[model samples]
Target: MKHIWPIAVMALALAACEAPPSQEDAPFEPQYLGIETRLLEGDLVNFHVEMRGARKTRDIEDYARCAAAQYALIRGYGFAQHVRTQVEQREGLWMADAAYLISDALPKGVTNIDAEVTVAACRETNIPTV
Candidate 1:
């Protein structure tokens, strides 16, 4: 009887120590607002993306990436290299400022993206592209 009570108490303590479900476990319901493209320089482009209900910063970054990929394809570029991305959230709105270098050939970097492939993926994921 005493041993059973102690075991029950230990089990309750262990259950209490278990971590709660994380935010990542929540269903993603992203609302993409829009994308703005800027020609920073020759072959360099900047994308400003806005959205809501983003699960995290990566969601906004991916939105910007999709815009950059489509823009590169429209500009007759086959590839783009990721340069930088800055993300912020305010009043439930998420925004990302991202830069990429569009090129006719594959850029020299691990972060390079093939425009066609990226655009296809974005479409498959139901993400909009410019």
Candidate 2:
């Protein structure tokens, strides 16, 4: 009887400590998906980003842009010019297919684009960038 009581208590404790599945475990709804980049040419990159857990279109686009900005910094660049971005939702995941031209200085005829500023904003918003 003594041994049985101890065994039951141990089993209960283990069960209580079990954690629920995290957002990454399941594929339903919006969760922040990570970015995949492909170098197309000198200073030009293509980014494929995904987000889950949020249904907002603008939020996903911002996540993609943040990724581009961070990527520019990774390549020793201070700015990135937006080439294009295509967004879509499939199987509950918001995907942003984007392209950018990274540059140490702003590309000719390009408006202001600061990688540091974009990365700061991404960190502020809890968005992952690389």
Candidate 3:
């Protein structure tokens, strides 16, 4: 009986100490910020691939995750992930925006796109619709 009471109390104490999931615990959601026709950085990447983690900026551990997000951005654009990309930063709901800059000339299908491409998870960019 004494041992049972101690075990029960220990279990209750451990359960009380368990932390709830934070924004950092959230999964990665794909995001993109549509820039003006002129902002695609030339032909290859017309849309700035902006990604934010479910966690806030303070939770960002390193540039590698940002880099992966950049690659994912290019992949999100229906382009090959062969090219190099750089990650930039901005504020976000839980995490900061990671901007992947594609430095090469975009392929023909990518250049001069008239409409914005969207995915299920991306937060919409505020480009005025004509």
Candidate 4:
């Protein structure tokens, strides 16, 4: 009986370790990766980018990686440095807050226009992804 229990435990351990392949290997619509962008245009354009989704896994690393990627993309363009970012998990979604600043090279405008643009457009718009 003792030997039988040991073998069963080993089998269960192996099964638990075997997580299925990643989405890259198999194409599946990503549950997360939705972005919310609010652009404040004027002398300095403030881009507030964040991740919108629930928290299924307690993967802090994943959220941090997402933030890094977004920050890199925004800085690469010509956005400002960073203003603020807020992150919250509701129900089963994860969220992040990011703000970028455009120090110079702004068009003549006294009014502040919050331009909501997509991530792709943000990169190609010559925003200087620093």
Q: What residue runs in model 1 are displaced by over 4 Å at the alpha carbon?
A: none
lDDT of 4 by residue, 42-128 (tens): 432333222333223323223433333354444454223434555566754555554545433332445211222333443553222
> Which scores greater on TM-score, model 2 or model 3?
2
Candidates ranked by TM-score, best first? 1, 2, 4, 3
TM-score of each: 0.86, 0.72, 0.32, 0.34
Model 3 CA lDDT for position 7: 93
Worst 10 residues of 3 by lDDT: 112-121
lDDT of 2: 0.84
**lDDT (0 to 1) per candidate:** 0.94, 0.84, 0.36, 0.42
lDDT of 1: 0.94
RMSD of each: 1.8, 10.2, 9.2, 10.1
Name the candidate, 1 or 2, with the larger TM-score value: 1
Worst 10 residues of 2 by lDDT: 22-31
Per-residue lDDT for 109 in model 2? 57
At residue 70, candidate 4 shows an lDDT of: 52
Q: Name the candidate that leads on TM-score.
A: 1
Candidate 2 segments exceeding 4 Å error: 1-30, 109-112
**Residue pairs clashing, model 2:** 30-52, 30-53, 31-52, 31-53
